[model samples]
Target: MKLDFTLKRFPINGRLKEQSGLPFSCVLQPYHRLPEKETSAGDASGTRSNSIARCAQCYSYINCYCVFDTAGWVCSLCNRHNALKPQQQKRYRLDPTVLQELPEVRSEVFETLAEDPIPVPMPALEGSPAAQQDPGYVSGPAPVVVALVDTAAGEEFLELVRSSLEAALEALPPVTRFALITMSNRLGLHDVRASEPSVRYVSLLEPQLRPGASAAAAAASSPAVACPLSDVMPLSSLLAPVGSFKGAITRALEENMVPEQGFGETSDAEASGSGAAVGPSGAPGQEAAMSRNSGGDAAPGGGVGARSGRSGGGHLPAARGLGPALVAVLDYLKVLQSPAFASVKTPDSEGGLSGHGSGASAAAVVGADHLSQNPSPVKLLLFLAGVPDFGVGRLV
Candidate 1:
């Protein structure tokens, strides 16, 4: 035969959803080991260009935002944990080194809340039962699962979440167990309740491994009765019905717990634009500062370690009745909206959520009345940190 040319065409789904935008994990695959001579040439630069290519700054799972060459993805919890910087590191002075040295801590619930939280208790809903004695409908409490999404880049993102969680827990009654879920694409659920006190090991729940899990569970985790904190998990999708979730969450609080008077409006100096107003310095259980600051890149490590490696953090607890909690977190992102509104930004607009038929106009459906119905009050607390700069206090 003179010549043979065969072309295999890759299939294109041809389904056009949304138009252009700016953007954009590999774990394992079969590969032939290169000879020592080839490896030596690759290592000659001494830039650690050989081992494995990873970001200098790594998260707990696969990196969602890989802009920083120094950044790598770990798990969502670790992503939030790693979002903290050196200056902000003081807030969580738990001594990770010491924690790492401790033996595994079993299912002991530790209340991180302050002895007395800021006392602005909202009026409780009238007539709601303290405990539901009903059958199938009431399954103890919805499992608690919290998912911390990245509002912006920087270590502060993680610190903000940690501070918020500590403050929230301090406000709640003591619990026996908890779990933590952080997600971008890949979901990681670390069972904090399962760990033996002193030892640090996360029981990872990977989505790929278990495809049957609900988006909420995959995004967050099951809200078992024991771990109340697990209620905060990733939402079904950014565009799902956040208000419905909020309503359910609010009902849960009114029935089972009391709303704490935690944070208040910020004064001009303190309210200089960041989400939360800057509270007094050294206020126990309070985040020292709030700013729109970004994070810096960690120094690079040899190839893959920096790019793909786990970030460290303990497991979080699961909470009872978390469906609404998941909804509240989803709503905070300002992505979900009713179908009635038209598009706000252009189809190709990069500012807000895309992929939906409507663009910026999509946000119009997220009205205050909708948020008022939110079942979970805790989500509102979380949304306070992520909402855009506006009169948020008035809106709440």
Candidate 2:
């Protein structure tokens, strides 16, 4: 099979381009025939391995482009040197078959990994959005859809977003839960279960933020957002059930969300020929692309669930307080609790987002490994109609 692209680059000004724009989906046909020399498994079907080598930093699968050495291999994509396990090192020295059998090393295009995510019993109130649950009994991991709306994106552009989100709402699985956040110099968290369209505004600005750094870093560096995300809205309310609360979500998008004047060029700028380069990358908006972080293992579950996707939070000029908000969200999910994210204190029984946050550093630069690594994947869709001209990561 042949492949093509829709965009050119992935990141824009230290921000994740997955939230940039366009569709970059890959349809994996497991039953398709493989090229003659491509299959190391000696069949038309590709290699089936229980384990695939992955970069500890970026969580990307190791591919043919990696440079292998005596100690370990350097990730071709992130250029981070990942040490091989002792057993893996021994296997590399003793048995040449290990390298020969790795699908990532053998095929440059594709490979099938047979990962068996433990199947959980469907929750009793599955798809019943209005259903309440035992506060203590957390269900399995459910796919989280956080739509970060740029409130400054005028009515016309927002209308397009409204329709698109509505269409996406129809396609979502019954168990999926979604969170809505509106940004334009400040942050607003929406509770889908509220009687009316309820959005609590949050100021996430820190006294000082180093330029060209991610929001994740600022949260790690200084005092976090004015309040925790749950403080703005509880996790239970944040992740509203798509099945029952579909109408509520649509209403929240419409009712009182008026566009705020921003510092960037108008929507007409793109049509009039603005040459800011954007690329087609498999990002959180696309479920499949979002799952790439966890070896594509987490089947979009919730509570007691762990998955990883694109990490680090980008702060737009129009979206200022976004960093602390995301850190709060990740804290709610316990993303940092995973060893992959950081080496934190042993979490006690009490569960809540508190001090010593996990995500990025106190530095101006956001490292690739200092991001969403494993076991907690949150799909964040940043809806922007124009380049941000206000805060950090501004196009200007």
Which portions of model 2 show Cα errors greater than 4 Å?
1-48, 51-113, 120-138, 203-229, 260-375, 386-396
Candidate 1, residues 1-396, lDDT tens digits: the string is 011113222112223212322111122323545455433433323222222223234422222221221221123222232333455234223454532321111101111222333232222222334211110111112223343332222345555565555555545432201223332211222212110101011122222224776554543443212222222221221112211223322222222111111112222222222222322222112111111121211111111111111111121222121233344334433422322222233344445542121112223222221222223223333222333221111121
Tens-place lDDT digits, model 2, residues 1-396: 423345433343324545665564446555676676755543314434444567899988776667787678888667798988764565444244677665566566554646668553343353344243221112345566888877765568878888888889999865566777777666666655543444455555553567997665754566445566544444544566576577777776765354542324443322322222222222111111112224322232111211132211122324434444455445655532354322232344125322111111122111211222434356878787655544334444
Q: Which runs of model 1 end up more than 4 angstroms from their true locations?
A: 1-147, 176-179, 196-396
So what's the TM-score on candidate 1?
A: 0.20
